[model samples]
Target chain A: MRTSIIGIYEDEKVLMDAFNRLQSEGITIADVLSPIPLHGVWEKLKLTTRLPLATFLYGAFGAIATFGFLYWTSVVSYPLKFGGKPLNTLSFIIIMFVLTINIGTLFTFITYFIREKMYPGKKVELAVPRTTDDQFTIVIERPHNMSAEEQKKINTLLKETGAVDIIESNN
Target chain B: MYNTRVRGILIKGNKSFSDVSRDIIKPMDDKTPLWWYISAFIASALLIWGVWGFYNTITVGIGTWGLNNNVAWGWAIINFVWWIGIGHAGTAFSIFLLIVRQKWRTSINRAAEAMTIFAVMAAGLFPLIHMGRIWDGFFIFPYWNTRGPLWDNFNSPLFWDVVAISTYFMASFVFWYIGMIPDFATIRERTASAVKKKIYGVLSFGWIGNAKGWLRFETAAILLGGMAAPLVVSVHSIVSMDFAVSVVPGWHTTIFPPYFVVGAIFSGFGMVLTLMIVMRKLYRFKDYVTDGHLDAIARILTFMSLIMGTAYLTELFMAWYSGSEYELFTFMKNRVTGEYKFAYWTMLICNGMIPQLFWFKAIRKNITIVFIISIFINIGMWFERYVIVVTSLSRDFLPSSWATYEPTITEIAVYSGTMGLFILGVLMFFRFVPTIAISEVKGVLKETSTLKSFTDEN
Candidate 1:
């Protein structure tokens, strides 16, 4: 069984303070769950994301693909004269621009879901209840071999840093 | 660390995170209110009446409408444009305010976006039903087929409208749904009933508000917002092109794109004001949808109303300056002094004149007066479309082709139905969904709260 140590915080500022103190004490945090997104939490946790870059690439692909499709259908496949205007034209730009947004947003949303392992009907095992409401929780993996004295010390530190409660769970 | 010098408190009451959740989610937990049932009943009645109209339209064909050869496009087109303009408010409110980093948008954006979705859905019905043969609507799509594999006219502005509206609808829905996920997760955790929890769980897509998820979520929001910003402008511009591309005297103009976009945002803000005021009053959400928020919207409408006025005058000037007889007749004679002058003046008063009342601080502060003005703006915008469509088509280049237009009972019924549909959708949203975005309101609470120091220390 794996053990986890959780510190429940009512306030975000206190949570941030406790997070920094835990880092200074050379403790590794497994994750922080928050009701609302805590400012600067990602940077504090040394997390980086490439979702923006992915969205840009998706958008570029959509633009190119849309333009090519419009050109092929209008100019190459079934070219027809309308009021003597050119068959291959810039009128497709608006459609291409719209489709780029549509494709980019749809793909990025899917990527987010896949990366996060999220889908409809997926069971949610919350780290701590009400973390989605008003609470912030700091989770740390408790080493199996850690002495009782060390565990008590960690609990005391959390209390000093204004954690409203400390919970240890094994699953 | 809000500078009080610049703006009022966004979330009026000093609310803790738990308090924010409790306040926002309270409505969903409580018994259905009497007003909701009353409103829903009225909306359903209107919807049923509208269905009868639609049934007549589909059965009797396009001949059932007030449409003649001269004024082929009447109330259906007018209502479509009006509803679309109303639809612009949600994305415009959320995305533009988001890009500008307006913290106040947090309290109101969710409801506004919901309004957008419903309004767009309502607007979309017009073009489809207006086709006279709704089943043949697929002919507008550019797809492969055995019949010469004939593609839709890619060069047509009408085709662009199809692409634009669908893209706008899909993008707005995605953006709105993405914003709602974290909030849904909150509701999932808060609700007592097992069924509610399970339903919200699926709706939330099992969101767990981890640090990484929040980061990605915020980043995606910005990305989507960036992309959708241009969409908010493009959708209505394309809608405007449906008219502007035609060589009809008042229809053909280079000013249509920007003018339509501005008009869209103008009317959209008006609708948002109306809806938000109602929501604020009915839900007792004064702390979240504070007077300050309404003030900010009124100011925006004031500015937009000025631009609308300028666009109107510029149209007149262009018609006269270009020395085109047809343009002059459309602007000076047909619309201004001719049969549609009532609609023209009504549009001017409601859209161009009434919103200017916001310049007075007292007027903007009064919620009732503001609400009435919003309704007037809605009416005025409808008339604006009517004047543009009817006047331009009714008396064009040739007198023989000219004919006056009046909406049949069926046409009016279909419009009433859309109104019913719009109201019904909003009512359902209120009853089921969290009217205010719980997570987003909490996210801004620290910065905008009056008791910031208290929250920080707690």
Candidate 2:
């Protein structure tokens, strides 16, 4: 029920030293948050979620909405003849294509939200102000198998690495 | 080193945070002056009268305008294009500059963007007002009205205008609102009043100082910028299609789409310059809106003018070289020399001629010269549309249908009203939100090149 929380200092050398120490201690990190993306954190963390895939899917959803809405409005809604053109000119594919493209773009925005788990009304849980202005942060969720003493040791290890400060979680 | 010029140009006026807050907030124009409320009321009254005038036109028939068989597209079309053209500067400031990394945009981007929203509101109103039945304007397109009064012609470019303009509005609004959040938070922090603090605080959306919010906000900002850039381009291109897709001699040129797009930017930037000049003077944000911005925008205006010049020449060549009598006559008789010939020459002399001065650093940097030239640019853009719509329609393929175009009194007043509306939107917005993005300005200060290198060592 106890987890070994670890915080690594944002300084490049200090962060690298802490990374080596963590690997040496066999402590696996859950996630890292930096003000900006660090140079090698992606490679070190092995994070493999395809946010782009989610984005692509959301894009398709938006396109479908656009196409479906336009089609519905055209065929089912106020249908009248202009230029004596048929309801489904099929030649009008270009307009639909552009509309779908615009809509898909509109939808791709949603993926950014889902990826961050943030929305307009969602509660913001920004722990450190400097992360936006100055600092980089690395967070590792403690493993369930870790003992209370092991968790304490991990905190001590983070403190030793010049983490600046540590945030401990019950999880 | 030259690349950092825009950044340096942006941050050079190092008056502190409080100075910015005060400069941006202080009412420079005597607010208690009767004219502030009087002008607002007069503009509002004009707006009401314009709306009533439009209502009368619509209630009577589309026939109320001077638009007839010969001049089928008149003031509404002209107004639509004008509003759409005005709409361009906002996204250009909000997206294009952000992409090009012109940090100087942070100062006037908010105001220019607010202009865009109101301009769109004015622009989008025309089609519906022109539709005759304000209640059933939806019938113009096969959109959402299940009664099936008329099916939308997919081939018509106007349909695309609705889609493009609406999409642009929504995208720009998102871009505007997302950009506003951090600034809103800054305002919330700066304001002492509990009501404003609560209002802005709630709008900032529970932004607890977290790395997660920072990460998401950054992604959203960049992504929105990217989204806005394309939307801006596409919107104008779509607007251009309203003419390019047509077969009416001068209006039907393949050159029109991109040509109009460039013209939109030219005019839009001119308006932006006019605005910044006024704002910098009035709000005492002289530090934020500097001479460098005027010079840089003048350069862009010059570049756009050159593109539009080529487009004009190519259009003429294509008309002549294609060996079509109608096309040749359209260009030779009307566009170059006809009843509207004066306006055509005026456009060339203003949009095409005045911009050439921008090649000189002195004129480009000279605020007074730039301001005057931008006014000319705006006039030229309006004349450009006037030439395109009126002259093109006034004389079509059939000689029997030919007639001179003129705006009804209603048309003139409504346009004046819309301009008033546009000015009012900006004037009112400053009363609500701080003109410049203070947090963004502060953030830029922190990222000043001199300090950035040390952070790397840390």
Candidate 3:
């Protein structure tokens, strides 16, 4: 969305090093993209993620609500007995447990998709086409307060850390 | 720490991430193979025939099948249990293996998961046909009827089955789709056609391979896997309850739940072996689906066969020890030396004795033998369900009403039709989706230090 220096690296190791170096030097990196997910990159960038926490909460809520709903339906709404079984049975517990898991799993996945803004028909602009294949890319949005010397230093650092190509894009 | 080689090298030939992507994505991009189309054509023909059989059954009434008042649960129930059993291996491979930290599952999990979805579809068909009045099949659901305001009996195992099975299908579908997202994104990047790209893009949901996204993806997979692992056990257990809850002597075993679960995994691995052996050969995925994967599956199948064999013997021992006349009659008289003794003995040999061949290293490693054994196991599992359902029901407490059961042409056609539908689903899946999870395969490739060393040497 803003003018950014996009650095493309052929290898994940070099891209990670350059990304950490830039983060350490106090440069605000817009994002790093790679063919495969690079784990620990968020911790390396010192960014806190709430996705896992959100998933857990969503699952818990779903399980509780599903169990409650099953209880209300079987006990409160319609108290019909079959084969002289009690109002509540151990078999209902198994059904309730499975429903909780089913509902919880579906809810967690849906919430993850929604929170991540991942949905059908969303257009994604690839900064580097090869980022989805065999390359890793780092995008650094230029700060208005940065001096020319600092910009030059960042460019040299990216090149030294094995960036095969550097492109300044307005995309 | 170096025990990654315990299962042998998952991927061979020093394949890099790019290599993995290319190999997986090639089938998607390339023209459909002649064999694929030929197989699809034959499957389609059989599916059409099965549909006609189903139509005839519905029109001609329940009398169309070999089912009677006594043998009410016939081929339909048998096929239902058989399909459900076949579906279990996929979930077991994906979820149980993931929980246990078996990384090699990544290579074959996608296709196996797809098989689960299709097998469940096949399983769902039998109950519908068995209903006879399938138009009123919605009665199985919990929704309030607009006409008579009928309410479903939640206490019924059949009702629980309706809930469990649909839940199982939806859960497996979501889990499969979620796992496919990143790989679909890769396909989006690799494709040349705009239409294909757009389709894959939407399916991928704008995956950017960001750190946060990856973390969420991994977390979600684990969560879904954890939920699915239990479901894989429970769905089959509930299916087993359809029999166990009944007072039928042979069907009312306390061991049905765990026994069914183990048999499901055993037969499931058998189906997986049957499919994967052919798939690896056809797709040339020897490097990814390597001998280690086959060996591991064989070992599990062997273990399951032994468990199943023990369960079979336990039924006999229970029958004799309980001294219940009916139970003893079902096992000793009806099953062992009864009219259907041939079917009983075949089940014993196919499901029990045949898988024991895998105990030998050479047989486990032999693709041809594994394939043949897997086919026999599938047949054996089918007969096992038949023996349980028909044998127990055909000769119940009353000796006056005893009659031998045989499946009619319509029933056989419908069963054959489901086979066609299943093969068609697998064929379509192979042509379209990435049969192997490319990203996960790449992840495993990165984790394998042995591969890293090999690449380093090169």
Candidate 1, residues A1-171: lDDT per residue as tens digits?
889999999989999999999888988888899988765678778888899899999999999999999988888888877767788887888889889998998898889889888999788878586899889999888988988987887898899999999998773
- Check candidate 3 and list the clashing pairs: none
How do the residues B36-128 of candidate 2 rate in per-residue lDDT, one tens digit apiece?
677688878878778767766876877778888888888888888878887899888767877787766777788888888888888887877
For model 1, the stretches where C-alpha displacement exceeds 4 angstroms are B1-6, B450-458
Off by over 4 Å in 3: A47-67, B1-8, B146-150, B449-458
Quick one: best TM-score, which candidate? 1
True contacts kept of each: 0.79, 0.22, 0.55
lDDT of each: 0.89, 0.69, 0.85
Query: What TM-scores do the predictions have?
Result: 0.97, 0.80, 0.95
Candidate 1 docking class: medium
Runs off by more than 4 Å, candidate 2: A1-53, A64-93, A105-171, B1-7, B15-42, B140-151, B447-458
Ranking by DockQ: 1, 3, 2
* lDDT tens digits, residue span B146-168, model 3: 64444566678898888788888
Instruction: Supply DockQ values for each candidate.
Output: 0.68, 0.21, 0.55
| Sort by lDDT, top down from the best | 1, 3, 2
